[model samples]
Target chain A: MLTNEILQQRLTEKFGELVYNFEQPYGMLTFVTDRDNNLKVMNFLKESEDLGFTFLNDLTAVHYPDQLGKELAVVYMLQNIQAGLRIRFKVFTDITHPDVFTATGIFETANWLEREAYDFFGVNFVGHPNLIRIMNVEEMDYHPLRKEYPLEDQTRIDKDDDMFGR
Target chain B: MSQKQNIQLPEGSLGKQTTTLNLGPTHPATHGVFQNILEMDGERIIDAVPTIGFIHRAFEKIAEHRPYYQITPLTDRLNYCSSPINNMGWHMTVEKLIHAELPKRVEYLRVIIMELSRIADHLVCNSVIGVDTGAFTGFIYVFELRELIYEIFEEVCGSRLTTNIGRIGGFERNFSELAFQKINHFLSVFPKAMKEFETLFNRNRIFMERTMGVGGIAAERALNYGFTGPNLRATGIDYDIRTAHPYSGYQDFDFSVPVGTTGDVYDRYLVRNAEIWESISIITQAVKKIKELDPSVFHADIPDFYLPEKADVYTKMEALIYHFKIVMGETAIPAGEVYHSVEGGNGELGFYLISDGGRSPYRLHFRRPCFIYYQAYPEIIKGSMLSDAVVTMSSLNLIAGEIDA
Candidate 1:
């Protein structure tokens, strides 16, 4: 049984100020790291015998247009199957250069997941072997899931934005 | 008939013998709208590259704009074979965010519905594998059972295929007497049908020869690919989400997670078949447990989120106000991040929601399990005979809706 506290303590001790915003929202440990240290933190979590979160449960990105320089938050959900524990970590990068180190080398599941994140949020995954669009057409010019993009078609004149509470 | 003799071949014809075969975006064997570019040498596949996204509807993008309650219908479209599980999973994610305490009856009712849908899903998967392996009788046989399961869902929620069955806290209405009757009838009839279905293929020499050693994946490699549910269980890892992290009172029920050694096409089939039995056992336990609880209790008592009765709305001012608030999507949602996963038909289907104290989620991502399995398809099917690829795919149970979502 690896409790959140023990895992938090180990992460803080090793990474120190490099990791911050340690929160246990809904009893799942969450923290933030510098975009540069994303792979380092993930590698440490996987290789460390005490905190073996070997399973990459999910990988996706959340875009916050209001936050400058930290617009995109690439979230990774990791799980330790034996202990039945899960932890989430975020690495924030700017929209202009949304480059985060890829975890495809560590977990093979990250290959297509990283492609999905890149396809939706335009997050350039550094060092991913084949980071082409997986869910969208290659000819698509813009990422569709960003907050700025409207859900409805722009050219549709019959429906008003006010009706949708936009 | 006249050109019986062999003509002179080009010098490089023997060297470059492999042919490129485009399997589908519409092929009957593919079963879904996804294309596979296979490099084949005669009947054996040398390499495969799958191209997906034919049915991508951008649900994640749409989810960010819709009110939380309205998102249930969108979840229904994913894995349509077992949509009740997806619906319940979405509701549970929101419930986790709001911290709603469900009654025992609601939990047990949910368990029954979810397990029934699991049976429906696995029945489709296993029977389709049989169909691919040249046994069509089992497919026709179990489909009647699937219709029976759908009839039970119709009794509960008035819809069958794209059910959108339950609300955030619990079901829209209490389970009717007919629903329970149908469940009992199916329970009594399903085992015999399933046993017959199994008897047809489980010991047959042809079925065994086709699937026994085909499309095998090591346990370590399956884990590395983030495989879950029966596919991972087929690789001998008993990491079931129901046991690992119990949800919807799954801990109250007694069931077993069946595992296999080789993780091949046959192992996947066996795992799914065994899971159907386990789901039946779970539903049986839930029905028994529900008998001890109050029959009238269905949805939880969360006035803010749950819609009020139409009759009450017409008579009472409080009911009308709550009705208006919920219908207008004006209920307050707290700012937080929550990730909830349910063991879906295929694997661990997760909902990661980030709400900013708004009417809708600020960002919502569905951790679709089929998406993960599809990426591993090319590797799993490589070096296998063309006929074996079809069996491997059906056994994996890849749903294009879930994959491209």
Candidate 2:
């Protein structure tokens, strides 16, 4: 009963041009919105009787350094288990001031997920209680998963490909 | 000597107060490296704080640097109990991005491998729960069945624990006759052993008392915490990735999703036991279905990703060129984002990939189900006995590699 068209229409009718870039890459309905309306859009999707996407399947971040002003993209994969419907949405924020509203109040599982996002890409979830490093140690000063940071240490010349076949 | 002058009673030690106990980072009862700080009032736990990431390897960051085929081994470590499911899940994710259509025989072969590993994973988890609750016979009894399953993996892919069994499109080689014999042998032997395993613990008064009503959670709370796989099914939710979103021709196989009420440690055990039976049925069906298809169609016709035969590589120039490119990890993939999940050992193991028209992925994230559900541990074990906490942890099937990955 819940087809892609109905879900898209319901979203468009509710949020009106606010939610854009409707797409179905590999048959999953994915859309994009600004960081400001993420909580509003997610709450509407959860509270609305017709659109009951209560299960938060996944929450992760993608770092794109080339994209100016929107260098960080936070992705949320939500599913309505009863209806067997899943929808993905992204909220892009600037790298310098990467702040997005917390979804802990909406989904309890978002607690550690937000901490993980903040630990890796430094996406500061506003009003997130106890937002600290989850995977990496507390003393790590830099977000390692950001595009600005390289996977390997540049200072280690011994393992350089030119000198050693690595 | 009775009271030393230098000795001082700590602030809360003078009065009767809760004792703080650190359960593990390497405790044998934990089964893995998980540290849970427990605030206890005698034998009952008042609160618990679980600390993970002792085994975090930063697989996501590592995947960004490695090529597509190179990431399969990384997935193998996610849940070593059932590495094939993770391997096949990663392959399916890439296959989805590339739009590679696989043959029926290939999919059936994958189903057989995946279900066999599922049985292996469940055997370890269920038997470990038995050992945690003062029952050791079941642990030693079912492990041989797990070993037999591993032998099948060894025959197929030449490895044991971390069986990076399959390639991007399909298997590296067709299933050998010996492999089929092993499958049939396991299929014949597993059912009787599983029935014995169930008889040992299903209605045993001691196990029932120790696990039932201990660390039980409501179905609604379990869902809010992102429970999936057997854990979610144990909570009475019939949501299964294989049925909800069928992939790798799971729709062709018919099997019922088992559910349990009360979502306690006992219910989790029963659900896993029932699921083992269902997996047996599925593997039997797949073996029959594979016989109907052509045996030569193992790997798909994606020469860019799938490596050519060794004989062809040695003799033919075109095969040599394809082998060199595939081995050197120079296959440039299209720029796209795809999220694919398979019903893994513990839950829904997902791969979220983003490619920017490069040999390696732009970014790759593993939606580790253990990492999500483990967050609900402190809540699940709070206000329960210390021993109950250990039993609950085993029932949740928290794998350290998957959690910290």
lDDT of 1 by residue, B1-405 (tens): 234447677787674557999999899998999799999988989999888889999999999888999999999999998999999999999999999999999999999999999999999999899899898998999999999999999999999999989898998899999999999999999999999999999999999999999989999899889999999999999999899999999998899999999999899999999999999999998889899989999999999999999999999999999999998988888889999999999999999999998989999999989898678888898888999999999999899999988
lDDT of 2 by residue, A1-166 (tens): 8988999999899889899999998888999987899999999988899889989999999999989999999999999888888899999999999999999999988999999999999999999988999999999999999977788877796774875644
Off by over 4 Å in 1: A156-166, B1-15
Q: Provide all candidates' interface root-mean-square deviations.
A: 0.7, 0.7
lDDT of 1 at B241: 88
Candidate 2 lDDT at B394 equals 97
**TM-score of each prediction:** 0.96, 0.96
Among all windows of 10 consecutive residues in model 1 chain B, the one with the lowest summed lDDT is B1-10
Candidates' DockQ values? 0.85, 0.85
lDDT for B274 in candidate 1 is 93
Q: Distance (Å) between predicted and true CA of B48, model 1?
A: 1.0
User: What is candidate 2's CA lDDT for residue B86?
Assistant: 98
